[model samples]
Target: MKATVYEGPRSVAVKEVPDARIERPTDVLVRITTTNICGSDLHMYEGRTDFEEGRIFGHENMGEVVAVGDGVDRVRVGDLVCLPFNISCGFCRNCEKGLTAFCLTTPDNPKMAGAAYGFADMGPYDGGQAELLRVPYGDHNCLVLPEEARERQSDYVMLSDIFPTGWHATQLACVQPGDTVVIYGAGPVGLMAALSATLKSASKIMVVDRHPDRLALAEEIGAIPIDDSKVSPVDQVNEQTDGLGADRGCECVGYQAHDPQGHEHPNLTLNNLVQSVKFTGTIGVVGVFIPQDPGSPDKLYKEGEIAFDYGLLWFKGQTIGNGQANIKAYNRQLCGLIQAGKAKPSWIVSHELPLDKAPEGYQHFDARDNGWTKVLMHPDGGSHN
Candidate 1:
């Protein structure tokens, strides 16, 4: 099988690798149809993380089950399914409580509670960016899609990660119906956050970013776009909310956040969120903030430390929620919205290429090239709607 292997910093190659097959009684082998190149994957692509050179690099995946282990009872061959980025055993204590992202059974490291396929320091599981993927604990990990899944692979594939993750951001911020919400970053996840807020009936939605294309996408979905390059994002958010600040805020840019001049600031979005959200308001941070950032320009970031305005956060009595999204918690409901034609997260997709073209997709997305908002790869060259 040909898989996208991480070669080094800002480099990837489509290399012929050994076929992925069922390795355990609980495993399911899937013939991957659609997979995504996520922004988080860029962290590894840029050599920011300790990702191994030979490892595959995709976590957003969906496909048809080609084979299943004897222990798998619920999933069957020929069933179209979308696998969550997190791989968890259903019987773990965390899994029982719907905290599948922090499941105790998947991670090999005793100190780490969560595991993701092809992610740095997550686990040993290979990703679904190739022709085949071996899914562990298949009965628990696979979210079976509806009969209409094949026609909407581009949309349904999002249920694997960004869709649920964006919804999770709103859940963390405690976004209520008719509440005013401000979101930082207009990337795919941030755009999805705006979409989620719209579906939840937010009275006002403001999205901040320097990219004109991304901000335009947010505006297309009824969100007010704040171009930080032209105006201070903090001032814009305050101005939009009549100086009271937004009722809720979300941080979707993570640690790789930068100014319009291309200077990286590890704490840029957090401080922006703290200052933009009203007193006593809630904030949710779903962006990836690693424990250590060896490649960051800031000295403090070398140790994964960010110096944000925590004093003001305390004085304002604002609450913050941060972590990886428990995708299983929201995927089912989000999938229902897609099936009912109420939501179409695929609107952000900007490119669709064959599996062999993944390296090109990664290069363009990494550069944040014009019109390269999102890229989906089809391993089987299947038509995507």
Candidate 2:
């Protein structure tokens, strides 16, 4: 098999790797068709985490199941599936309660918090960026896509991570009908939050970001654009929401947030999100924040210890809900929306390259190049190839 391997900071290569197979009773082997280069991967690409060299690095995956272990039941050979970024045992205590992200079954190594196909801090499983992947607990993790979806692999592939993650942000923020929702960061994930916000009947949807292209995508989804590069997002959102602030806010920027000067401004988005919403509003923070940053790993605990105005939050009586998205909880409904032609999240994809081009895709996405919003990669072989 051929796959992209992360060699070091800003270094990756397309090379031959071992094949994937059903290694456990609950496992399924997926012949990957399309996978995506996600923002989360940048944490490792930029050398901002304790990621090891030569590790596979893609998680947003969609493929066809070619084989399944004897214990697997929900899917069989030839099922076109969209694998959730999270790898969880369906019968775990957390899994039974819809908290798949915190699945107690850590990988055999026990150093990783949980297991994901190809992600930092998410265990030893190889990513689907390869020609094939060994999907653990495939029957529980793979969302079987409809036949019509096979034609739009790029769009449906977003289900693997950001699309569902952004939707998760909105849902966590308690976005309700007729509420004014403000989202910080108009990245692909932020744009999806804007898109999902519209679906919820928000009275006004405003997306903040310096990138005009991202804001343009937000506009296409009926969101008011806030160009933070030109003026303060706080000023714009304050004015747009009549000074009371938006009814709810979503923080999609996470710790990788950058200031105009290009330095990592970790708490800027959260501070803005806290200030952008109403007095009693809530914040849905789906963007990832590493508890320990490798760039300045000395800050370790400080990496997650964002210095924001909690006093203001207390005074305003606001609430916050933050963490990873339990993707399995929402993939089905989101897929149904896609199947009905009601949502086309694929509009966020800016590039679609062959799997061999993943190294280049990582470079473009890492540089945050304008108009380079999202990239989808298709491996060589199997169904949909």
Best by lDDT: 1
Locate the minimum summed-lDDT window of 10 residues in model 1. Answer: 376-385
Off by over 4 Å in 2: 109-113, 297-303, 381-385
Residue 73 local lDDT, model 1:
95
In terms of TM-score, how similar is model 1 to the real structure?
0.99
What does the lDDT come to for candidate 2?
A: 0.85
lDDT of 1 at 322: 93
lDDT of 2 at 244: 90
**Which pairs of residues have clashing backbones in candidate 1?**
none
Error of 1 at 157 (Å): 0.3
Q: Local distance difference test, per candidate?
A: 0.95, 0.85
Give the top-scoring candidate (TM-score).
1
lDDT of 1 at 82: 98
User: What are the per-residue Cα lDDT tens digits for candidate 1 across 1-385?
Assistant: 9898999999999889999998899999999999999999999999999999999989999999999998999999999999999999988899999999999999999999999989999999898889999999999999999989998999999999999999999999999999999999999999999999999999999999989999999999999999999999999988989999999999999999999899999999999999999999999999999999989999999999989899999999999999999999999999999999999999999999999999899999999998999999999987768
Global fold similarity of model 2 (TM-score): 0.96
